[model samples]
Target chain A: MKDVSRLKSVLEKGGFAVTSECGPPKGADPQAVLRKTELLRGKVDSVNVTDNQTAIVRMSSLAACCLIKKAGLDPVLQMVVRDRNRIALQSDILGASAIGIRNVLCLSGDHQSFGNQPDAVGVFDLDSIQFVQAVRNMRDQGIIVGGEPLSHPPDMFTGAAANPFADPMDFRVVRLAKKINAGADFIQTQCIYNMERFDRWLGIARDRGLTEKAYILGGVTPLKSAGMARYMKTRVSGMDVPDQLIRRMEGVSKDKQREEGISICVETIERLKQTPGIRGVHIMAIEWEEAVGEIAERAGLLPRPVIDDQ
Target chain B: MITAQQKPIDEIRGMLVPYKRILVLGCASCVAECAAGGQKETAMLASTLRMKAKMNNEDVIIQEHTLDRQCVKDFVVTLDDIIGSYDAVLSLGCGAGVQAVAEMFSEIPVIPGLNTEFIGETRAQGLWVENCLGCGDCMLYYFGGVCPLARCSKQLFNGPCGGSVGGKCEINPDVDCAWQKIIDRLSRFGALDRLETIYPPKNWSRKQGGGPRKIIREDQQR
Candidate 1:
């Protein structure tokens, strides 16, 4: 609706937009990003280039997004405040737009302690809300943070992350509202394995009319094995994988676990489609990029609509 | 008050490797309250250092002293008469106290024996929780006396991040989500609406900027 990118047009045209992620390689290997982009090329409407996702060092998100754009896929550049101050962040945002990257997701990334370089200092100069608000100011007012006018502001579709399953669940909806009020045009939430809790969260979101304010994309990651399911349930913070789903994965033989994981993802996508207030699904096939095509096909998201005209 | 904890015995011994004579100095104020760097702690550390040195067949003299407040110049001035006796001053006070002692006795080496933690209160017996960042500004009144800056791992002012689980922080299960406490307290006081007002990006200049901060009162200054 904002004439930002094809993904925006698809969502505006009432199509169930499918998006996925591509974690850039740790080194400067363009082929790795190109290969992942090729796997997700036609299956999803856009791809999110993570900014050192989980605080681990990787190729810069802007560079990866540029590579994705070269491969003919729309890249949603993810920017985290954990590693950069305001000056670097604004410079990168403008640089991303200069390179034809349109969608940008603002996030307060995982703390450095969780990363390999635990001794690294975190520069959380701005929180996620402040980041969203700053980006919106740059886009609409043609100004940088501090009221400094920009010669040509970046025209980008601003997106943010939402976690429906984090603690103090009652306050989650309010936080989402705050994000929307701060000018988040779209929201891609944390991976969804607990549909009931997510549905409940969506109910509150719907009541607050946040669904109308921002396009909500439910996150789904296909579990590769029983071990993966257990890890998601126990180790991943803010994740809500149910015990029943883990048991279902454990009940299957090792050979069938992968297939079961796909089925779970398909079922999740189908349920999310039916759930109110959610406009689309974001598939984070985390190192399992090859399965994205199959998951999208099985989940009935194939033939992604082409809405080039904004 | 400024709270701190003693460095491990092994770590303290490592810093004292080069020195034969040392003064195990302690502070009598905040560190004493937290049971960290007090008169009793100084004596105990002096004894341990002496015993450990003897076991290693090393000759050393460990003197113990406690000041009213090691951060104060007047309290640190008491060391002037007895300065030349020790090779180093192993300050059992907080970082501020250690710096003050180092400044007062410029010629002698000052080694920190305790890690200055934060401005906090003793929650219980042998328990202390950080309650302030000394951000140079105070916003506790707005959040029902619960400080998000010190309590929240992310220092989020709007609300809880998605990483909170069961009222615990994403970083650790032991940490209570600061937003949860703020919301609960605000709800009890019927001041939950205060949270709806979005806080702008913090002015870090006032909190941390330029060189070291200083406050002078004309009335108190001669």
Candidate 2:
């Protein structure tokens, strides 16, 4: 778990571990991803390459992660258990791990109906908890997806998503415990705006004895504008925005909301740093990345620490 | 057979918007069986788009084609030569087939005209309903062939909730109660007493993610 400790200390020394998302275009335009890396090159810790995000279909996540790596950036290749079964999932684990992608995030993913193509047949074969186990199984058991012995084992830090605001918050902690029991080394959460409620979730996680077992990263996304804020608040499922944050957005002019959003994000990071037991924050700026450096600086997450090579 | 259903249109012109050149692709595998969007739906969309284009005093090209199977690569390869001619492709197959087309031609911009609903089988003529969420585990034997996991609406692991009234789901009167069906089937088979034992919650892991769920014969493995 020293890798986990080193990953944490790197972020703790400076600011949060900011991760941006890259949605590859449907057409054969690798530039959609390459351009982003050029902009975020050396600016962030790692970029998450999505897997057919809305399930409308696009370039493969494995391919995009490879491109991100080629562009001199660390990529957390994301895998969704929705379209793939356990067999395909374990195969994909070998596929990604063999490619030298060490960081992987497991997501249950939005249902097919929520994607661009509704009416899409879903392949649930495995959900979130099961996904973490598959990753862990590959490393420890040394068994391939086909139950064959692998010549070389994969070194993957298995991680899964946690939604603190899911209907019953306590159930999420139970799910987290299940993740730890299932062999999840790290946990990245859904976007958090309601800090007070999220802190309560941390207390619940502590009570469940998940503090020492897994690395927990709070999910934070910077709302670039008032429209984006409102869309996330109302449209995005399983998301809730505090009234004060809403009021703060309402007070700002349309043009300044972007800056106000950065400020709000800074405020969130500062508040998050004070909270005990939280390992780090996974900043999802959505499409906004240039503002990330400024927010980190404003939050006093400065003076990058020396790199700890894996 | 892949059961697919189509929503009938007063007319089909509403679907082809802003695109003058349209390609209508249908699947004979699933959608074709249900008569939802199969070949019939493809033709309907094609003619409807042509009529709509004519009324607007603009020229529109609708090239209609249906493959033997949409899910298979060999069948999809049928469009390999002619795909470059079309501006956009409208698929009447499930979402999987449409994505395959999109993957086949990254630039063609295929659009879906039919909504690929649940993985259902037609009980009789023109009736297809969802039977399972494919939770990766099957406890069908314990429930006398009735799945409380899928049909119960609440996905209850136990028997029917108090909500199952008159052998119908509380949410909808028309929908038959999953547990009730189970109880009836079990009683008929003298397996009804099995319901008394409390069933454990599902372990979704065995269901899929430990690895890709596979059904293969080493004998069949090439």
Evaluated with TM-score, which candidate comes out highest?
1
Among these predictions, the greatest DockQ belongs to 1
Show the colliding residue pairs in model 1: A167-B164
**Any residue pairs clashing in model 2, and if so which?**
A86-B208, A86-B211, A86-B212, A87-B211, A87-B212, A87-B213, A88-B212, A125-B208, B6-B36
lDDT of 1 by residue, A196-241 (tens): 9998999999998999999999999999999999998898888988
Supply the DockQ value of model 2: 0.04
The DockQ for candidate 1, computed on C-alphas, is 0.64
Interface RMSD (Å) of candidate 2: 9.9
Chain B, candidate 1: TM-score: 0.96
Tens digit of per-residue lDDT, candidate 1, span B131-178: 898888788999899998889887777768888888888888888999
